[model samples]
Target chain A: MQTVSIDVGDDGTLSAVLRGELDFTQAARIVAAMEAAIDDCRPDSVRVDLAEVTFLDSSGIGALVRAMKAADQVNASFVVERPTLVVFDQLNTAGLVDVFGLRRA
Target chain B: MIPETDSGYLQRLAELEARVDQARLSPEILSERAAGLLAGRIGCRIDEAHAHLRLLAGQQNTSVASVAATVIGALEIRRSTSLRQVRHSVEEALRATDQEPDQPVRVSAPDASYSWLDVVQQMLNALPGKHIVVVPVRGDDGRITDYECVAVSPGMRDLSGRTGPQLIGMAISTAYPDIVGGPVWRAWADSLTDGHPRSVEPFTYVHIDNGDASEHLLTVRVRPVGPGLLNSWVMHDEQTRLAERIDQTERLGNLGYGEWDLITDTTVWSDGLYRIYERDPADGPLPRAESEALGLPEDEPLRRQAAEEFGRGETIDLTTRALINGKVKHLRAVIDTVRDAEGRPRKVYGIIQDVTARETSRRKLAEVERQLHEHQQDLAAEHRLAAQLQHIVLPIPETPVDLPGLRAAVRYLPAEQASRIGGDWFHAALAGDGSVVLAVGDVAGHGVQAAATMAQLRHTMAALTMTTTSQPAELLAHLNRLLLALGVSTAPATAVIVRWEPATHACTWSQAGHPPPLHARAGVAVELPRPAGPLLGGLAHAEYGTNSLDLAAGDILLLYTDGLVEHRERTLSEGTAPVADLMSRVTAERRDYPLDVLLAGLQRANPDDDTCLLAVRRTDCGNGHD
Candidate 1:
């Protein structure tokens, strides 16, 4: 599988491009790498892009939620952008949509 | 024998005699005194006179000397005193008689009594009513019962013309047999059998229409007096009365009502509600904390719901499972919130009911639903497995084969329902000798086991027929053996096999407890003959009979599993007739249609079951067709 990538803008806004599946196998690595970069770069706001995400699960949502909370601890803004309908519905039902500032495409 | 002495001596003698009469001295003391006195007077031995005197004293109530003195000296004085006392009593009585001349006086006597009858008669005659008549009933067994009859003051006998024979000597039961046969009589009889009284006050008495019947629709009061004598009295034109109110206080008070104040954190419970909660209502209302604590731990969600309703100022009617007295109960409560003018919650009121029985029934219903769901799931899983097994056992042939004179196509339609997916199979394989071996079989039931049996039978038939020349009878016999053996040891299968020979232009077929295939030629269809045999596996020693048909060129033969033509709701003949009609129509319309197309058409013909059609046609050599 190809590695998913993340980019940070000059204005301290971070963006992640997720590819393949955000299933169990990839959620942990994505969360860890994005979190480490957020800590090092000290971005003011972060957005995770899920346009490339083929599959998403409860674990994926948990990783995102954890990352959001971790960002909050550091006083950085957190958001998820362009999640699929299925993932969005699951997160909405589980009451994690507002916590992560999730939005549908 | 008079004592000639002074009056004082005489008085002293009298005092001594009175003392002797009053005291209970022993016989010896009497003898001692008598000896002293009579020692000189009586010349015989004093002991003999003393014995005789003691015997006499014992008979009388005084000492022997006192008796002797009374007989000799005091007798005259006692008679005189008695005479004087009698004269004084007579004088008093005469004076009372002078005051009331009609009064009678009698001399009193002891040790005797008047009879009960006399006393009862006196009591009855002394009452102030002149119209009272008392009749005493005497049973043959010597049991006496009394009844009173009161006539209308002057005796209405003149108006009635008839005498009182009907009123007297008649048992109440005999007079009113309807009353005796009614439920009241049975109840009264039970009470009386327990030796208690049952009274019917102001009941209507229907007097038989007799000449001059003045008492004809009288109100009668009845009471059982003694054994079999029912006291019945007739009242003229009495107003009837009845109880006005019925008792239902217990039913109304059974369930309790309650209210909870969220703002004040207070709860008010009715007496019955407290009792329902198994708490004493006398001890104020239960603290809200304690009341919630007493509920089952599992009911915390319901408590939260009730709290939410109170917050929203909404009424909540809910039922929850509770534990009361260490036993699980279903409690039903209808809760309503009283709201303030600003739409704020004031208090939550509810009616709490113990619905343990209803909850138990609901639990049982849920349990039954769960069981039914589990059973359905199990059956569906079994069906899936069976379908898979059937797929593995009798897989569809990838290609059609060229038999000597017949071109054959076979299709197998599985059950429509997911839970009925099972052993329905069709086989069309070319024999080693260039003959066609076609077979279709259905195992009885629909499930994993049936599918497995179908697979086994189909595989065994293929293997057995491979070793022998393709003879329909021989192949069926082998299939029958396998089926019978498997059935005896396990589940069995039903099948039909067709063998076609191009050289002879004839088709030989045998049936083993399977529906016969349809033979259609020139748009005319008929069921092929079935061989004689019992269903495979039903009997240990059984063989299927064979049937044959000569194939004319352009003729079509159809073989199928019975699922295509049998349904649970319809008989075999009913299901087969429709399929046969469809086959006739389809072939007549398009005899030249491809085998696959024909099979698809047949599937369309019956949509309920998985349908299979094996259509075979022998090419005709006439008119240079071949």
Candidate 2:
């Protein structure tokens, strides 16, 4: 599985691109990367670019929920962008699409 | 005047007297001879001839004695007139005698006192060696008035065999009852009156043995000679052979005939019927009720119906199963009624046959059909289980929701085939840093294999999400490489990734051969401008591209797979309009509802896709915090 990548813009906003699948088998790795990106950049808010993530199952949705809770604790704005239909369906089924702010592509 | 016996007259008278002398015959002998002659000529009896002679004499106003005497005179006169003809007839009768006694001779008569019998008998005697004895007789009762002995130079008996009157007055029945009660009697009795003379029909008569254990058969016939009298003859032999032929026909064909008298409740079965039922002839003469007991238990009702229909005067042919000697068999029975002159059933007749083989085969055929039906149902149930397992393994999401900066949502609609659950999926995630990564992809194909592939890809994506925060384009390229590593080179996937920063209001998104997402912001909805790339798992080094969008405060981002925008018969752009309209509503309504409500509302509005929507508002700290 591919690891997560975060690119911080000059304006101090962070965009984290998630790769490969997001499910129970790799949720821990994605979560750890998320924390590291938040710490390294310490940006004002976070945006996750999922436009390249190929697949998502229920465990992937659960991992995203955990990330959302973590962002809330830090008072940092958290958002999701360009989710594949697969990722959105998982969020849709979990009833958390709006919570992650999945951008359309 | 004295009648002169002239010498010429007297000599003529003398010659006439001598002529009378030469013709002189015993009136009794002549009468007997005449009777014999008439009996043969007219096929009547001797006594009947005597009565006829008397009646003819009375009608002529002459003495019976004179009539008798004139019979020979008249015969002589006839002989003289047709000597050649007489000789021819006499010779023919003589030749007939040489031919055989059984060979009959016919003689014609001239209405005279002495009939053709006299001529026939004369002809019989004239053939040198033949003799038929005749005794002179006279009867006062007109039967036999007189008897005397007379000698002719060429004497012969009138018929062959036993002679004389010793066998007279014998009752015919003492010999042949068949002759007494049948046609002979009618012929003989009719001869006693002024009836036409006839010969009795020939029939065999049986003479009982002295011990009464055996009998002899004879063919006897009688003919009326004259009024009230007849001559009869009997021949023996040829009747045993005829009776044997009738018995042979009865045995073949296993044929039996029977009749039941309804009123008397008496049943009669033929010999064949008893044999078929394996019953002794003496045992049966049973009633219809008893005969019914011969059928098996199951066949009793059918037997009863047959009997009832016969009682109702109907002809019924019924088949039923029976058991004989502990083995079941099928029997076809026919019962018919014999009605009296009144249109009511008087007797019933029945016949039976066997048909077990046909019935057995039919039952076996039905059993096979039932088994085949059950086997088909079993196969159908197995298919249903397969479909159910596919659904549980890869489920479709029903609603949309929000994550964070990226306005992302997805839809996973199962395919329409009731037996198939398709492989379409969408994923949305908020990583640990308040950053959101979302993806929607369609695994190649449908059903169980597709679902299993989806599970693998989905877990792989989540794992990578935490490992690195790569750009969306690089993320897809990496996933493609990972798929190739996992031996899924044949399974392709299309996905889009969107990452958003709430504070900067910027969204970076990439597409890997997935449908572009539609963005609704500032009251307008359009598919976001984005770079395109090949689907994952297609090539070893397939690349991807990303584009950035500045998302304003209440922007709604909708992400989905081709299933939402592509139908086989329609263009993808046709499907985009609806998603766009719903996106516009969500963006417009974002300020009035919470993130969850807004997501739910957008999903409800776009129920066609396995829709996933993520709506996030840019929150300001001051007003809400106070």
DockQ (Cα-based) per candidate? 0.01, 0.01
lDDT of 1 by residue, B480-576 (tens): 6776555232344556788876566668898765668888776777888666644444334555667888777777788886556654344456667
Please report the TM-score between candidate 2 and the true structure: 0.34
DockQ for candidate 2, please give it: 0.01
Worst 10 residues of 2 chain B by lDDT: B144-153
User: Which candidate number would show the highest lDDT if scored against the true structure?
Assistant: 1
Q: What tens digits encode model 2's per-residue C-alpha lDDT throughout B331-382?
A: 6767665432223344557775545566778888998898888877754564
- CA error at residue B401 for candidate 2, angstroms: 5.3
Which residue pairs collide, candidate 1?
B413-B610, B413-B611, B414-B610
Task: After superposing candidate 2 on the true structure, give the runs of residues whose Cα lies further than 4 Å from its correct spot.
Answer: A1-105, B1-417, B432-434, B468-470, B481-491, B501-506, B589-626
